[model samples]
Target: MKKYLLSIFTLIIPIITFAQDSTAEKFDAVFKEYTGWFVEGIFAEIPFTDDIQIPWVLFVLVGGALFFTIYFKFINITGFKTAVKVVQGKYEDIEKHGVDKLYGDQTPGGNVFETIKDDGADGEVSHFQALTAALSATVGLGNIAGVAVALSIGGPGATFWMIVAGLLGMASKFAECTLGVKYRDVGEDGTVYGGPMYYLSKGLKEKGAGGVGKVLAAIFAIFVIGGSFGGGNMFQANQAAAQFTKLFGLTGDNAGMYFGIVMAALVAVVIIGGIKRIASVTEKVVPFMAGIYVLAALIILFANFTLIDDAFALIFEGAFSGLGIAGGLIGVMIQGVRRGAFSNEAGVGSAAIAHSAVRTKYPASEGIVALLEPFVDTVVICTMTALVIIITNFGGDSSAISGTFMQYGVEVKEGVEITATAFDTVIPHFSIVLTIAVILFAFSTMISWSYYGMQGWAYLFGKGKITDLIYKILFLFFVVVGASISLGAVIDFSDAMIFAMVVPNIIGVVMLSPLIRKELKKYMNAINKKEDALEDGATDLVDEM
Candidate 1:
């Protein structure tokens, strides 16, 4: 596997050297020109009016979320308590109930091969690790850069819509992740292969939509691989390298390349260990990074406690009135929904990939927990970031495109830099801390995405050691390319690819949602039973006393 990976890396070395050596100006144009069409196609908008054009994919996401929210009778609200308990391992004993189904005959085909018998649980990772792994992927730059971008265009009103989107998005997360586990394929060695690729194909086949499922699965796999390369690998590496260079005053043509190489090596070390390793690393890093960032936001909020109510008022008002922005009400909604989807990643089906790897007999257990992602990511974390930005920008000129005394002091600032500026506003010299957070966010996101992309790669290619090694090397190469190249078009294309996943993912999810509801019912019943048993035991103990 190592030799095969090395041979593949050798093949890409020339391309990397050429890209690295090429004039930055020339390659930027070349990259944009080559990749421009994909971006245009994926983000193509429908003209709702002379001034309003909404991307169709955004509608796809919103529509699925709305449908699921209603169909599940607002599981996002009803399931929240269960989700919290599940993540807390309250029903840990129930994990054993599903070991037979996980390792035994799951489909009509039965066991693909004799797999390892596990005494404790049938999954590769615990529920927390899966949640963190998925969380690490979504709760990165989007929570930082994307929130700032939305606020700049959509104003405070965008924050309100973002929260609404995140709330509705919970149902979508529940549906897809439930299907992820239900359709997952467990190998003889206990390796789990799941996600939209499996559920779209396998679940659809079971539902008599075999041909549709195959095509959607293939398309989803292809797009997921591209997404992994663009958004997951390169975009992350590029941003991290950029942050590192800016913070330390690193300069030179090769600075980003060097940074990318270091990141690639670190990522390679973790990803080579597969999901278990990825989960372990994320379980630690996600909480730490998120906690620090949230803590800072809390401090800022408290510091501006008097302005909190007024900031929310502006958010509500701006959302409806659009604050006289270009697109008005429609525009703010688009920006909020787009950024919300980008941050929390509901309906995209990526979280389902991570959640599918959890140790539980009831797939719905992870599905319930999966709903927390949007709440934590967009509702909690992104909201904190937005509040800080809004609060810092308070009492300043509302008319200026970019207000004076704002972080960048211009009409527009770069992405995550806006958040840094917000932090620095209350706490002087906090940009250094923000920069570290950004790098950690980027690093953690890349590792998780590496796992996501590799799953797609493995699904498309054979799930062999050589295939895995080859994908890892190629993925590492993209990390370097992403850091060094200023490929606006490429990044745009990759962002589109990430959103494009919603199409097939939602389709499969919509079809398989009934199955998910059934699973949810079963899981809930078990939870009730467990609670009843515990209550009875408590009552008996009280009587004896």
Candidate 2:
């Protein structure tokens, strides 16, 4: 693995040397040209008639979310208390050990592969670590950069739709992750390898659709690898590189390439250590980074408290009347839903991969815990970021484009830097601090996504040191290329790939949702009646004790 990584970096060093004499624009143009077709095809509009069209992925995501919301009876809302308690370890005793008298006591799967068995739970990481690791992936650029891009394109009206999408997404996230935990494979050495690839294949197989599940699983694995490269890896590098270069005025064709190399080197260190290492790092880093960014956002919001109502007024008014918008009503909706999906990734199924590693006996427990991601990510963090930008008039003069989001004086190229600019308005040189947060955000996201993509790669190629090395090499290569590309190409590809995971993921989840509902029903039943159940399990506990 080390030799392969070294060889790969050796090949890329020329690009850095070659870039010295060229302009960055040329790199962007070539990237856009080659990959443009994939982007166009994925985002192609499906017409409703002569005048109206929407990306069909939006329907897949929203439709599945709505179905889940209803089918599960709004588990996203009702499971809140359980989710909190589960994360706080209120149910750790039962989750780790056993409640033999419960609704349906699941025997831990760790015994299946005794080639190696670790002590404790069947799963690898704690619930909190799983949540933060997953949170690290979804929270960063989408909240900081993607939201900025959405507002710039969709206007304030998009904020309303963003919140709506986030709410509906909670249900989608719950179903996918519940199935993830239910169908996961615990390996001999205690390593976890699961995700949409596992659930779609395993869950559907149990539903008597084995052949269909196999095909869907393969497609999902391929899409996840691609999605990780674009949305999870490249888009992150692009934004971080853009912000880093802009802050220090680092000009030249290779500025982004130089930044990408450094980031890739840093990322290589942690990913080589695998999920446990990744989890340990993220638990500490994610909170500190998120706190710093959120605290800054809160301060800005308080300083401009008077504009809160007005900002919201614009959001609501723009949602209904997109008069100055490009695609008008539908355009605003697309941006909102797209960014919301991109931001919190409720239906994307990536969280299922991370959440699968959580140490819990009940599948629904992790799923319940997983629902908080969209609320915290999209509803809380993303909303705060949006409010700050809107309150500061951060996108620029709304009338500049004769009523578009073409904010005068704002540089869209910098992506996440725009958020920093909004912060700097209330606090001087805040972009400097923001640059640090962006780097950390990008770093955390890249590491988590590396694990996700690795899972998919292992699904397709079969897991081993060689397969892992090959995937890591390929992944790091994209990180560099992603940084050097133009924002439009990078973002278009990123959005297309990430949302594409929704296809297979949503199909399997919706079909398998009944099982998830039962899982939720059983888990909640056990939780609500734990006292009596625990009393009955005293015999089992006595043996272990």
Candidate 3:
């Protein structure tokens, strides 16, 4: 741990020294151009029409989501109630088997075992903790900045398709997370290791596709590691540092760099303890940040209750008609789907890593709970942000052409800035509050992604303590780099790496989906039998009364 901390300082000192030597603008320009060149090919778009070019990655994600929805017989809709019950601990007392070995031998002196064990528990955390951890990763910048950017570009109509994509994405989340749990590795010491990596390799090997599984798992691990550095660590730190500087009126050539160092240090404290620590923090932070952000949005919506109907009217109209946006209907739909996938991350298979650690014997139980991620992230929180933006119309021109507005004599840009403007318009000086929310959102997301990327790193490079420590240190360094550098190319490369996971991940999911269906059926049977037994007990008691 000391060595890891030393490594972080070693990386930071040189970066700060270099930033001191060069002007910020010059540094940013070079970084952006270089990064863009490296990642442009991977993130290249496929032209569907003259004006509607969707990234091939988005197509892979959307296609997998749609296929899973049909294959699972719309489990997203029919299993919603079951998901809620599972997360609420309704089935916690269900008898668990095959875990006696997890408990060590104890002398028969009426003494309790001091060592904590799963005791038939297959995972490390509760259902709710697992869901919150996954939600923390997905429900961050995408809900704030991603939504604002989409609405600005696609207009009010884009909201309609975003919701559509989220609904279908629930099925995709269920499929991958179920596999995550089924193929997971449970150490004798109660450590849990699961994700696309394990499922792709282990699960596929069980189906006589060992060769293909090994290749896919390797590719997924590499992409996941890159994504953790770029999208999960750096991009998040960059946005948070930018927002913090803007809110406090901080001015300096290295302001962002300083902020990134501080942020990285804080993140290092949480990540050093591994997933258990990350889950514990996220369980608290996800609900608090999401609740505060949502409550604020609700207050804004309630303040303008009269315009609620009008906002919905515009959303539906713009979605179908394009409402004079650059690309028309097709463009609006593309924006909505693209942004929705980015925000909820249904087909990315990253959530499966988080959900796989859930303390449940039934893998499908976690899968059912996993479906709620997209619903809460996109359908609920993101919708609130879009509504706030649409109702305020950004406090100025509502036109879609420019995608910019004026606020207090300042040019309101896109992303979180635009969302912040919408909040400030409804309640004066609320930008400060929005700024805090963005920071919390970024912090929670960075820590969660660190765990995710570490899991991948461990899988590929041997799960030694040394390897884990090195990866964590490298991750923290990227957090600082993301804040200090204006690497458009760097961020693009990382974003592409994240999207690239969808290709190999979905292939594994598609092949293993039949097994997921079997697990779902087994889980449903247990739930139904329990319900029936409870109903019979209630009837007998009523008769006695």
Give every collision pair in model 2: 395-407, 396-407
Tell me the tens digit of each residue's lDDT in model 2 across 165-245: 898889988999999899999888888898999988888888899999999999888888887888789878987887788
RMSD (CA, angstroms), candidate 2? 4.9
Stretches of model 3 off by over 4 angstroms after superposition: 2-7, 19-38, 95-118, 394-413, 538-545
Which regions of candidate 1 are displaced past 4 Å? 1-15, 23-35, 98-120, 396-402, 406-413, 538-545
lDDT accuracy of residue 529 in candidate 2: 61
Please provide, for model 1 over 1-545, each residue's C-alpha lDDT reduced to its tens digit, 9 standing for 90 to 100: 45654565565556665676646558678877887887888889999999889988988999999999999999999999989988997777656544233322335556432253444546789889999999999888889888888888777778889999999999999999998888888888888888999999999999999999999999999988989999987888888999999999999877887787778778877888889999999999999989999998999999999989888887888888887767888888888888897788899989888998898788889899999999999999989998899888764555323453342222245867778888988999888988888889898889888888888988899787888887888888888888877776677788888998999999889988888889999888777765665665522111100
**Angstrom error at residue 181, model 3:** 0.7
User: What local lDDT score does residue 435 receive in model 1, on the 0 to 100 scale?
Assistant: 85
Which structure is stronger by TM-score: 1 or 3? 1
RMSD of 1: 5.6
Q: Model 3 over residues 391-436: C-alpha lDDT tens digits?
A: 8773345543333352221223558777877888778888888889
What's model 1's lDDT at 243? 90
| Residue 124, candidate 1: alpha-carbon lDDT | 88
TM-score of each: 0.91, 0.87, 0.90
Error at 81, model 1, angstroms = 0.8
Evaluated with TM-score, which candidate comes out highest?
1
Model 2 / residue 263 / CA error / Å: 1.3
Q: Scored by CA lDDT, what does every candidate get?
A: 0.83, 0.81, 0.83
